[model samples]
Target: MTRKIWVFDTTLRDGEQVPGAKLNLYEKLEVAQQLKKLQVDIIEAGFPASSAGDFDAVKEIATKVGNTSDLMITALARAVKSDIDAVYNSVKYAEKPLIHIVLGTSDIHVEKKFGKSKSQILNIGVEAVKYAKTLLPDVQYSTEDASRSEFEYLWATIEAVVKAGATMINVPDTVGFAEPEEFGERIFKLNDRLKNLNDKVLLSVHCHNDLGMATANTLAAIKNGADKVECTINGIGERAGNAALEEVVMAINTRSSIYNVHTNIKTKEIMNTSRLVSSLMGLDVQVNKAITGENAFAHSSGIHQDGLLKSRDAYEIISPVEVGLDDMELVLTARSGRHAVKNALEKLGFHQITNSQFEGIFEAFLELADAKKEVYNHDLYVIVENYYAKQDVHNENMTYYSDHFYELMDLQVISNINFPSASVKMKRGDQILKSSAVGSGPIDALYSAITEISELDIKLIEYNISSVSRGKEALGKVKIQVEYRGEKYIAKATETDIMKASALAYINAINSIVVDQLLPVE
Candidate 1:
């Protein structure tokens, strides 16, 4: 039997609490809508009593996104009356309103953070849950740093809150200190203890990634009978961040034989959601981050690529299509072997090639791979093109063109004047596109001309420049981050002309969108 794991997304709450990852009301609402599309069980909008801005954002999400969808709306509160009241007022209009009351039960938090005794914390948590239960049927109480708290004290707090009508009992490894085994034991014991009190109450675990074991600990708890997971998108939260929702959900899904549980998350929406949160929050998801990372399903090693070509299961445990990718990426890099190179060629429609021809191409590939970190398709194309030219084979199929949606053919910019203007010539397949625009600045004007020609809803969020080498004539390197339909794409270009470098960098990002990364609009 597959048990359904409840996914409570706190991206708008704990995730936004990161030092500089805060989002405006519009952005929060955008995330809530995306979360709803992702089919998370609950959305913790924000800590309402934290500020007027948060209160308004939570209220708006509850009334608009929450009430319109089947998802539950919730917010965090200390085990204080005023905090619980603020949460209630904000999410009152939600169809399924949940108030999350967190309090410290560990001796460290009780003595140092709150300066209160165990009994005082217990009373405050019980009173808060009791009040929240009066307003909504769903109320969760978290034992802050429960892993470090005395078992007896933690049990007593659990018994008290269950008695006070907390529908969900959350045990958080608040500081991410607990190992998987230790965390799982706590959840198992709590489940057993709660069976005698109120088995109907849910058992939830929230883990942090301080020791880089949050996903491991979370899976361990689920194995020991935790019914709910408190997580955030892209794992954005305090300090080292919370257990990533995508990692946890996909773990349960991919390794169902071990955990025998499933989540409501539509895994197909995982990529879009991760990109949306990363873009709006102005945080970049690490390329190697699990699940939604750039290289999660990308294979680069020679042995791995060979096995992957033979069978996906030889190296990949999960299919890229399962998480909404069209196919697993076989990255051509220095480590990639000849087998991957041949497959790359076949994928580019060079399927009918002589074995000797392929061998000739392979040698050239190795030389280029040694000189570069990764070989793009264009680089591979040139290798093949040069191979044919050396062989004196007039191959009509051999062309310098690619499947790029937009290629910068030419660029002309005029700046240091009242009206900073630029004209761009681009190629999309066989068609030529020419556009000109004036902006408040030179880079802005170049981007405007590109945007006008591409007709994409591309937003330039991050722009940076640096020098590849020293001196006045040093190669100016431009790096840019752009958002397309909520997903972020990064591109870099180096040129002696700073303005041309900026244009090429921006076009590289746009071409990335047009090539393979244009996520479908939900």
Candidate 2:
């Protein structure tokens, strides 16, 4: 049987440190629920000793709904009584609580940072772990700079903490200096030298990605018998960041044959969880990011497209579907072949194109492809509409505004009455006009002004407002559809202020007439 590797996600503790990535208590709880669904073996909730807010967040998470029985919920602490006490208080309500106490072990760290001798440092590590064990049986002791610590001192610190009842010993690559092979060999040598190491506690690895090798180093450490890998989602952390939980988990699962390890992660939830975190944190993953990027599965070019069509394995090492992504795309460009066009149409549910129809549309698409540089889905829709037009079939149906006027009889109405001060002008058929009047709100005033100036009298048929995205900073989106000159025009605009949104929406509608030629009834 393959041994189960513990997946320790420190997203709450370390990922929260990313600049501008702060999550309030509710957001943190939402993320914590996602981590739980990911089936991580442990969650380092936060450093409760950091501040009162941190303590409250940790404490609330410990007591909140869905604090499961088997999962080891944890909080980080310094190897000091006050810090340990803060962690203990926060996690006191949890069924299985882990107190993670960390202290520096390297001589340089001791001398420069702590001004303590080697023996004093060892005593502090032992005393802290022993004391924490009394409060909670599951105590994890970490050597902050274990990768750079002198071998003898590291071994001594490990032995001391183990004897002090530490359940797990974490060796961190604090500055991410160790190479993969060297770091793995270090764990192997420690296991060899300290024969009682496995007898007393499990070995864990905490790596940073300063050298962009954090995941590799972590896997190597696991190969050398480390039982737990500490990481964060999306590689978020201080400075260069930490190993990404998604990357590490996928690597372990995808290469299980080579590594002979497994983690209890719900692989399918990877993409959804990444998106949720990205949205809540307000960090947009780059289009080319691995695993969850928009372009991760997108393929272009004639050669690759042909090869991918033959067999996905020809160009893809891992199936996009394996990472909860859809099949690769074959976009039509000037270089695209007939196979690409047919395939794109088939995907869009447009099957069985006649020879003449295909030729006509293909020729027109090429012309459009030349003009636009790349034919998009919307362009394809236009081509299809034109084809249907020759068949005398209705490609689209129009609605009369008077038909739906009764639906607005008793609906809730909130109008913008406080119109901002502005100069208004409108024109039609060589008429320059100007007028202003306050109505129920700015939107009403703007409409009155536009009517006076343009003299292209139209009735306000429909208006709606929505948000481009969620949050206080979200852009308010406004859409207006109005009838004039026996035609209807739709216009849209997004802005932070409602008044600006109203003005922009009106302008967008008017531009649809003046600029895009979707003129309304005069």
- TM agreement with the true structure for every prediction: 0.85, 0.73
Lowest lDDT 10-residue stretch of candidate 2? 403-412
The residue-by-residue lDDT of candidate 2 on 1-522, one tens digit each, is: 787889888888888888998888888888888888878888888998988988888888777722678578889999899999999999887778889999999878999999989999899999999999899999999899999999889998998888889988889998888899999999998766555555557789999999999999999998998888999877778888898887888888778888898888887778767767777886665557667765677676767777788787888876766665555656577777666776776554456677777777787788887765556543565666666666664423321212111110111113543544344544332444456566766567667766655446778876767666878888777767777778776555567776666765665455434422322233
Report the Cα lDDT for candidate 1.
0.87
Query: Which regions in candidate 1 have their CA more than 4 angstroms from the true location?
Result: 370-372, 396-437, 440-444, 448-502, 505-522
Candidate 1: Cα lDDT at 180 = 95
Over 86-174, each residue of candidate 1 has an lDDT whose tens digit, in order, gives 99999998988889999999999999999988899899888888888888888999999998999999999999999989999999999
In model 2, which regions exceed 4 Å deviation?
326-338, 354-376, 385-522
